[model samples]
Target: MASGTEIPAETVAGRKGALSTVISIDAMGGDRGPAAVVAGLVLSAAELPDARFILHGDQAVLSPLLARAPTLAGRVDLRHAERVVTMEDKPSQVMRHGQGTSMFSTIDAVKNGEAPVAVSCGNTGALMAVAMLRLRKLPGVNRPAIACYWPSRNPSGLNVMLDVGADIKAEAADLLQFAAMGTSYARNSLGLARPRVGLLNVGTEEHKGRAELHQAYAQMSAAASAGEFDFVGFVEGSDIPSDRVDVIVTDGFTGNVALKTGEGTAKLISGFLREALGSTLLARLGALLAMGALKRLQARADPRRANGGVFLGLNGTVIKSHGSADATGIAAAVRLAHQLARADLANRIAARVASTGLAGQDAAATGAEAGTAE
Candidate 1:
């Protein structure tokens, strides 16, 4: 038997119906191990008293952790998973021999409908492979994408960017699908009705970029009105942090490079500020005077606050937390998964894909008719 704080009065009723509120977690996949995962769960449990967790890991390791987190006892259901997928393991290797592993079990829970969403801080490639194989893609979705929240100058303080690393290649039609999927995600998750969509390109000029991008630009421009999104035409890399667009669509190769570059730049800026603030006695004193403002700035720019990279266009929602994430980052990922699950994000993506498919079919039919008339 496990130990933890009893479920609160308010959450008791909801706990009875755990299917919707439960989140499947891979407790042994992170770099920090089960301790950080459990600590994160404790933090999340404090905030979301009604949310339940289906933890997958070795019972010997997780049992003690749960015993320490009394507040999370009754809310957690542990499933013993003997194996773990390591960071060094290739996706192909894991796919063939990853059965009974925590990551696989965590995703299986969501696929089996035991939980609505799954959160894991594991190998990205392996996780993606397992997810695609198990959860599969939604109807009309050719290639699934990994979408992440980018801190930006938008009113909501964040913008949605997709195809971060799911697939390195995307055609003109795939880009349009990304835009439509991103629009739905913004609407459901960010509460934006008709999000402004922008395609990342070399420049905002009409003739810029590769031939595929140019073709994609024309398609996106023509479909903007019908897609219920405002296409701001082509946008440069700088527009990712700008408030001009709520969704930035790009192929995975470009998006991944941009994502890593942005993360590194943010870290460099933060380090410079710290160094400047502590270089001299007077500088330290000045920092003390501005401590409160600095705290606010740190809070606003904290990457941990936006820890989850959502895998969109799948039949189920899967949140990939950073492998090196600590307790706070894990909690943030759990919080995001809970939010997306509550909003029925999977169903929303399905509807968006279906709509886009119909639109493509209509356009093709129209072109065929025109050819016949000519």
Candidate 2:
């Protein structure tokens, strides 16, 4: 039996009749516990009128939290979980003994057809492990990826990047798969007809980078026409948030480092801006006059506004939200999940990969030497 207390069949049936889409959420996996989760749900419920949620967590802790938010009534169905997978838990341990946890319950709902997508603000490694174990990889996927929205100067105001941290290394064929998967993501999430793809390298010159990158470059170039994307050859780190490319493809180690670096740099810049704005009377006066513009800038740079990193290349969609996310961040993650679920992104990615035959192109060379991801 599943560990959590199942919602009564009558209740679920009634909910299914009323709601257009169901999103399964792990209520206890976040650092803020169920309070932030329920609060975020309240926000999501208000924005997504036709959506309902299956919240998994300790009933004792969640019941009161939900009671405090009257707006969430009838929109949320709580499942009682006896335990939680903590940030400190190893992925291996969680995979073996996480059946009773809220995180596992969250993924199981999607696996059982109760929800089309699952959202969890938990340990990234553990969440990926559990999700892969339960949902399994999509056909022709070797290493699943975590794609995130990067603020960019594109018309859509965003770009897609993949393998943020699903695994540390990706072979040439894997990078090829990432490009195809990212193209599908941009099409669905960013509404791009044909997104521009870029391979991360030390320079724009194709001659640079490791041997695997050279192979990936050729593969991406060859596959771009069939994949329905524009391969921009190679891009530097500066191009990540630029309009020059709509998808920045890299191995997980480099991607994860770049992600954290970008986040830290954003925070640092915000702090400097605050300090400079308050440094003198004249600066303070100028700040007041530009408050509206400043607010817009802050909104654009806010990490919480772009909180979800989607786990791509899986049979089912899973959103890995920031572990320390507050209500606003959690709401953003939920909204992203809702968007992807509506778009049927997973199957689209699978179809894209299969169509291009990217997954099977280099099967015999899967174990060959590749670039040093670190």
Candidate 3:
């Protein structure tokens, strides 16, 4: 069992009414191809026994790998494809030319109800674009956002952030959409009620923002007043550590930078610790004294926990992990996908939007003449 502090108090309550979770994984879509993802699928399968697995990729490429791991072969159904989308390809190019690509096939399967969730560590851009264009919105959403669950220093509940690396050039309306979408995500996925919403601005001041920022701020402010959400105002990147808010909102570009910066920082610190502990026996002894503390810190910093990113607002669940993610990362992603499917994120989001009667219109949110979101 995980240490009490290492787990959330809500885990038990959250697992009360679990749903049937099935996932389709892009078996050969990441930087390392099928090897790492297949290993992760096997690991996740053992952990999530109820999660049926369909591994989509080039049969020839994956068959040999699975032949070596016969145990995995018996568990996973092989879904064959021809082409593979590369890491360096343009989003549009990959979507159009990367026909029969594992990522596309996996997403298609999830959308078609072959599975409840799809996990990909491949071309993130293509995954988001394809999920949006294909699965479309889940009833009341305008644009789908990338949702990452953040572990807080408080350890009470996981914070959710969105729009990471999707629309860097997003406008105010887009940010507001992200906020609403995030609110829905927090409620549906994390089971947080009246989840706190925050705008990731430079400062907490109402006036602190860019041109688009000002517009988005005003819109979200009105939404809060209208009782649409529990909007908590602007938040700085520094506030991510504390449990000040349940959802941090921003545009795709800004959110991506924040997410990458956080990831890089974690890597840098971990590397520094390894190097420090390796150099001398004296330092190693010092590390040993603090091994428990170090494990706790490292566990908190582990990318595996944050590896899964939800493509919020989609008709179906699509998860994106880091482009360089390996087997361990992929395994965590499948677990997260299972968690999301069990939570029924899409349906919850739809219900929240419907209850607000806002549905597709947040015009009044824009502080405009109550027109479109713009």
Candidate 4:
């Protein structure tokens, strides 16, 4: 398919209804290949009967997969692409040579308004590079942040955090923008009317951590009312899984490390539990008694339930699923992308950025002004 070519809605057979939501998928991006991607679509189709997909990948490989899955027969429109962006590909390299790649084409569909959202399990850097190149950033957004749902004790069972490896460094003004964007996401996605926001720090004390965080704290406090979120001051890393804050804002470096560490820790705990449960025949009998409760706990802590990392501050919604996501994980990501797209998350972030007034001023100047104003 040509870049930016518009595939008419009539071409998709199962999407004649007016309420159907269209999603573009990078079929060749996941580690497990097109089969996993197609399987995910099938799972999503079973749950979301009104969802339609525009799959971009090699026709030869995807044709047989789609044929086997009768559920997606009329709900999908295939857009063939010859290239694939590997995990090793750098963002700059992909930018220059990724014309017809699946990742690029998937994002292009969203840019052309053929789909409201695009989901890719491709290289994070390459996906973001292509998305920014094609869809561009929303007005007044100096930098785009990647926000993800973290399972927590909130009523919604999740909290929003941003800049999880989208960029390593952020100024005080950027942090404030992340807060605004995160607040909008939490409100729209999690159904929070007034989300509480926090700045991640080494210590919860006002005087702890770097100068930029202090500046960000002051700015967030000043803009919380206008941004429609409550500023909860500084929160330590331990507060991420706590219900005290609904949104946590941090630079990409810290946020990415924390995210990986949390994932690792969850896996470690799961492994320990499995070993302990099967340690003896008596323990196995006890495990059978507790199987129902264990299942509930597993479901609650499942990483697959929170699969997509939303690219905030973009013109269109782009969800970056984990590269190694299985069918279940991909389905979770698809559901998230659909919800955000249906809610018009891009416009919400844009409006929040405009209201917070973080985008208009220079980063350094905004910090100085915020300090003076406080």
Q: Which pairs of residues collide in candidate 2?
A: none
Candidate 1 residue lDDT tens string, 338-371: 7776666786678667874423222112232111
Report the C-alpha lDDT of model 2 over 1-374, residue by residue, as the tens digit.
Answer: 12112122221343558525688999987888789988899899999876789999999999999899999987889999999999999999999999899999999998887787899999999999999999999998888999998888888778888889999999999999999888777776676767799999999987999999999999989988777788999998899999999999999999999999999999999999999999999999999999999999988878888899999999889999999999999999988887776666676677667764543222112221111110
Clashing pairs in 4: none
Backbone clashes in model 4: 0
Model 1: worst 10 consecutive residues (lDDT sum): 1-10
Tens-digit lDDT track for model 4 on 1-374?
23111223322223465646789999997889889999999999999876899999999999999999999988899999999999999999999999989998999988887787899999999998999999999998988999998989988899899989889999998999899888778777776767899999999999999999999999999987767678999999999989999999999999999999999999999999999999999999999999999999998998888999999999889999988899999999999877776566686577556654533221121122111121
Give candidate 1's root-mean-square deviation (CA, Å): 9.0
lDDT values for all models: 0.84, 0.84, 0.72, 0.85
Cα lDDT of model 4 overall?
Answer: 0.85
Q: How do the residues 224-267 of candidate 3 rate in per-residue lDDT, one tens digit apiece?
A: 64435777888999886568788888888888898889878878
Q: Point to the candidate with the largest lDDT.
A: 4
TM-score of candidate 3 relative to the true fold: 0.84
lDDT of 3 at 100: 76
Q: Which whole-number lDDT from 0 to 100 does residue 178 have in model 1?
A: 91
Give, for candidate 2, the lowest lDDT window spanning 10 residues: 365-374
Against the true structure, candidate 2 reaches a TM-score of: 0.91
